[model samples]
Target: TGKKYNSAAANEAEEKINIAIRVIADHVRAVAFAIADGQLPSNGGAGYVIRRILRRAIRYGFTFLETREPFINELVAVLSAQMGDFFPEIKSQQNLVTNVIREEEASFLRRLDQGLQLLDNVIAQTDGKEVAGAKAFELYDTFGFPEDLTALILKEKGLDYNKAEFDAKLKEQKDRSRLANEMTTDDWVILTEGNTESFVGYDQLENTVSITRYRKIDSKKDGVQYQLVLSATPFYPEGGGQVGDRGTLKSINETIEILDTKKENNLILHIANTLPDNVNTSFTATVDADLRDESQSNHTATHLLHQALRSILGTHVEQKGSYVGPSRLRFDFSHFAKVTDEQLQEIESFVNARIQDHLPLIERRDIPFKQAVEEGAMALFGEKYGDSVRAIKFGESMELCGGTHVKNTADIWYFKIVSEGAVAAGIRRIEAITNDAVKAHFAQQEKALEDINGLLKNPQDTLKAVVSLQDENAKLKKQLELLLRDKAKNLKGELATELQEINGVQFLAKQVDLDPTGAKDLAYELGSLGTNLFLVLATADEGKPMLTCYISKELVAEKGLNAGAVVRELGKYIQGGGGGQPFFATAGGKKVEGINDALNAAVEFVTGK
Candidate 1:
C-alpha cells in the first residue's frame, strides 16, 4: 500500500481510499439505523452484530485509507442526513448515535493499544518473529480487540500471529453460540402427496387430515424428535407472537403426541415424539382447546395494550415486538422513558373499560396490504407483507394481524401488568397477564398486603405506620452520624501526636475510626495547621481497607511530592488501585488487615530505610 502525502494525490490513487470511504459510509449507516431502532453495540446478542459491523468498517479505513485519526464518527452525520427521510429516527436520535459511535471508537483504540503492547511484550520474551494465537485470542475475548487488527499490526512489524490457531479459537466461540439454536433435520420423506398444507385450527379444533411428508430431527437441547406435515390440519403454527398449539394425533388404536406446531417457509410442521404405525391411514389432528383459549385471550389483550400505549404515550408509539403465551404476554414498543405508575394505572383502566364494553372481533381476509393500510389499519414496521393480508379489529383497535383472537373483548376477563422496563435505547417492554393469570396476580398481591399488615402488628393504616417508622429511622441515623463526628474529633489529636519529621518533611501515618468522608475531613483540618507536611490516614471500613493521602501545597511544589502517586503505590498492599490530583487522593481495597501495612508503607515513603 502506498501512502499519499497530499489530498490531490490521495484522490489520484483512487481505489484504495475511495473504496474504503464508500464501504465505511455504507456500513456505518447500517449500524446507525440499528442503534436508532434501539439496538446498540453491546458485548452480546444483536448488539454484538452491530459492534462487529462498526469495527470492520473502522479497520478498513485504518488499513486502506491510512486513517491515523478516527474518521468513523465523521460518517455518522452524513449517514443521518442522507437516510433521515425514511428512517427519521436516525436524525431524531442523532446525538445518541454519534456519541455512542465516538465512545466505541475510543474504546476500540484503547483496546488496540493494549493488544499491541501485549504483542511487544510477547516478542521480547521469545526471540522468534511469530506471536502465539492464544495470546491474540486472549486480547480478542477479554478486551474485544479484533484478531484482524492484531494481524495487520503484526504484519507491519514483520511478525505474525498464528492464523490457524486464531481461526480455531474463533470457530470454538461461534460453535458454542450456535449450539443453542442447532437442529439436525433429515430431508422430508413423502408418505403421501398433496398441495401445500392448510391450517384449520382457527375454525375447528379437530380435523381428519392426510400426511403429506414427515422428517426426523435430533437436537442436544431436545432429544430425537419427528416433524410431520399434514394436509388440512387443525394445529396452529407459531407466528406473530402466539405460541404453537399442542394436542394429539389419533387414528383408530394409535395415538401420536403433538408437541408443537411451527411454520417453515409455506409449510406447517407438526412436531411429535413418535410416528404412527400406518403412514397411509387418515388421522384426526386435535389442538388443546384450553391452551388455545388462554392464548387467544392473551393475544387479544396484547392488541389492547398496544392501543393503550399509543394513546397514552403519544401516537409515535409503535410495536417493536411481542410475545403471547398461555399465561402471559410481553409487548415491546418504541419509547424513550419508563412508564410512570399513574400512566400504568390509566393504561390498565383503558384496557379494562374496552373489555367491559365487549367489543366484537371483526376479521377480514384476502384484502390487499396497501388497501388495509389505507383503511386505517396499523402495520408493523419489520413484518413482511404479501399482496393479500388479514385484518383484525376490536372497535377502534385495528391492525394487520393473523394470530387467533377472542370473539369478544370480554373473554379477556381482566388485564394486569406484570412488569415494565427498558429493552434497549428508544425501546420499552411491558409484560402482562390476562384472565386466569390475573387471578393469580391478585392473590399474590393480597398475600403481600397481609404479610405487611402482620409485620406492622395489624396497624389501622399500614402505609402511615411504615412512613412513621421510616421517619424514626432517619432520626436515629442522624444521631449516629453526630456521635461519629465527635469521636473523629477526639481521634484527630492522637493522629496529630504520631506526626514525625524525616529529612525536613513533616510526615504522619495513623489509623482512625471515621468513615471515608469523615477521615478526609480530618486530613484537611490537619493540613491547614502546618506547612511542608505529608499525611496518610488508614481506616477499616466494613472489613475493607481504605486510605487517604494529603500533601501540603508547598511540599507539592518544592519536593515534587504527589499524593495520588503515593496513595496508588501504597494501595497495592491493600489489593486496590486509585488515583487523584497531586495534592490529595484516596483508595479502597479488600484486605482490611492491610490497613496497618498501608500506613507503615507511607512512613517508609519518608524514611530511606
Candidate 2:
C-alpha cells in the first residue's frame, strides 16, 4: 500500500484554509447544539445567531474546501457520535439536526451563487477599486450573504470595499431594530411582602384575590402597559405553548381589562393597559371563559393528535413544539417523511374517534417527576421539569403538562387538520382547528365549493367539469403556439430578403411583430441560411421591450463579433442590461418605446460607425 501523505491542510492551501477548518469544526457545534436545544435557524433573534454561525461554516467550506453540495449536514452524525453520551439530545435528534443543516446548506449555497453573480455586476459597475458598502449591504439584506465573506472575495481579487460605509449601513439597520423592539419597565410597587401568587385557573374561571404587586411598562410597539400580580390568579400565564389568559380584574370602583398574562421569575404577571383605581383594594380575578374554553379544547385536541401520530406513524413521533390558542392549534413534531393526505385523514379520524369516546380528564397535581414518568406519562423534549410535576391524562394519552385542558374530550366536539407540511429537516408541523374553529372552517370550505359550483353553472360533478375546462385551455394553448410558429416562419422569409450587406456581413436590424421567443426563433433561422450573418431582432410583447441577437459562428470567429456584447450595449436604449454566449443573447426592459432605438443602434456594432 503506497499512499502518499502531503504536508498540507487542504489542497491549494492558504493561511485562511487552516482557519476555515477550525471555524467549521467550532461553528457547527454551536449550530447543532442550538437546534438540539429547540432553536431553529431563522431571520431574527436567537434563531438568527444559529443561522449566522451555520452560514459562516458553509461559506468557508464553499470557498476553501471547494464543497459545492450539502456537506454541513453530514457533520451532524460525527458530532452526535462524539458527544452523544454527554449530550443525549443531539444523538436523539440527530436526523432532525442533519436534515435542518442540509436544507439550510442547499438554500444558502444557491444564494451564494446568486450573490457571486451580483458581486460581479457590482465590480463591473464600480468606478474604482473600492466597492460601495450600500451594494454589499443589499446583498446581505436581500440575499443573506455575509458582509465579511463579501470582503474576503473582493480581497482575493486585489480589491477592497468601504468598511466605514458598510459599518454605517449596518448601524442604521441595528438602530431601526432597537427602536422597533425598545422596552422599559419600572420597579414593582410591592403591595405585599412575600410571593404568594399561584395559578388557580385549573379549577375556576373567577376568584376573589388581592393585588400583591404591580409595575408599569413602556414600549414602542404596544405603547404603555401595566403588570399586576394577584395574590391568587384564575388567569393562566403563558406557558407550555399555550397563550396567556386575557380577562378582567374588577374592583368596587372600576373593571380593568387584562390584555395578556405572562410568567417571569415564578411570578404570574397579568398585563393590562391601565392600572386599578384603588391599588390596595380587593378585585375579582376572572378569566375569559369563552377564550379559555376554546384554548382548552385545542390544547386537549393537541394531546390526542400527538398520541395519534405516534400510534399511526410509529413511535418515532415526538413533540418538538406546539401552540394552543383560541382560534387554532399548531403542533410541531419529529417525523422523517411528509404526512400523506391518507395519513392526515387517518390522524384526524384518530383524534375525532377519541373525542367521540368521551374520555374524561384525569389530572395529577404535585406528583414527583420520576413517578409521573414511571406511570407511562410522555414528557416532551426541550421542556424543563423540576422534582415535582403535574400530569394530565385522557384515556391512552397522558403527558406531564401544566397547560389547561378540556374536562372531557367531548367538549372538543370535533377536530380537523387544516394544514400539514415540513417545517425543518426532520420536523413536520400540523395546523388544526377544534370546536368553533372547526365549525367556521367547514362553513368557509362549503361556501368556496358552492361558489365553484355556481361558476360551473351548478354542475353536478364539479371535479369532472374542472378537468374538462383545463383540457380545453391546454388545447387552445397548443393551437396558439403553432400559430405563432407559423407566423415566425413567414416573417423570417420577409426579413431575410431585407438583409443589408454591412461591411461584408449579412446584417438585418428591425422591430418585429412577434414575441421575444418568436424573435429568437426567427433570428436563428436567418443565421442558418448562410455565413457572416449578424441579426438583431427587437420586439415589444404586451408593452415590455426585449432584444435578441444571433451571430453566425463564422462571423463571430472571423470578425470577433460577440452577440452578448451587442445586446448588453444595446440594452442601454431600453434602460436594461443582459449577457450570454458570443453566438446568442437576450435582454429585457420595462420601456417598450426603446425597442426601435435599440434596433437602430445595432448596425453601429457591425459598421463601427
Per-model TM-score versus the true fold: 0.77, 0.91
lDDT per residue (tens digit) for residues 165-196 in model 1 = 87898899989979977889899999766676
RMSD of each: 6.0, 3.1
Candidate 1: 10-residue stretch with minimal lDDT: 1-10
Query: Best by lDDT, which number?
Result: 2
lDDT of 1 at 149: 75
lDDT of each: 0.84, 0.89
Deviation from native of the Cα of residue 355 in model 2, angstroms:
1.6
| Per-residue lDDT value at 173 in model 1 | 90
Model 1 residue runs over 4 Å out of place are 1-6, 9-51, 54-172, 178-183, 208-211, 250-257, 272-284, 500-515, 522-540, 545-583, 589-609
TM-score for model 1? 0.77
lDDT comparing candidate 2 with the true structure: 0.89
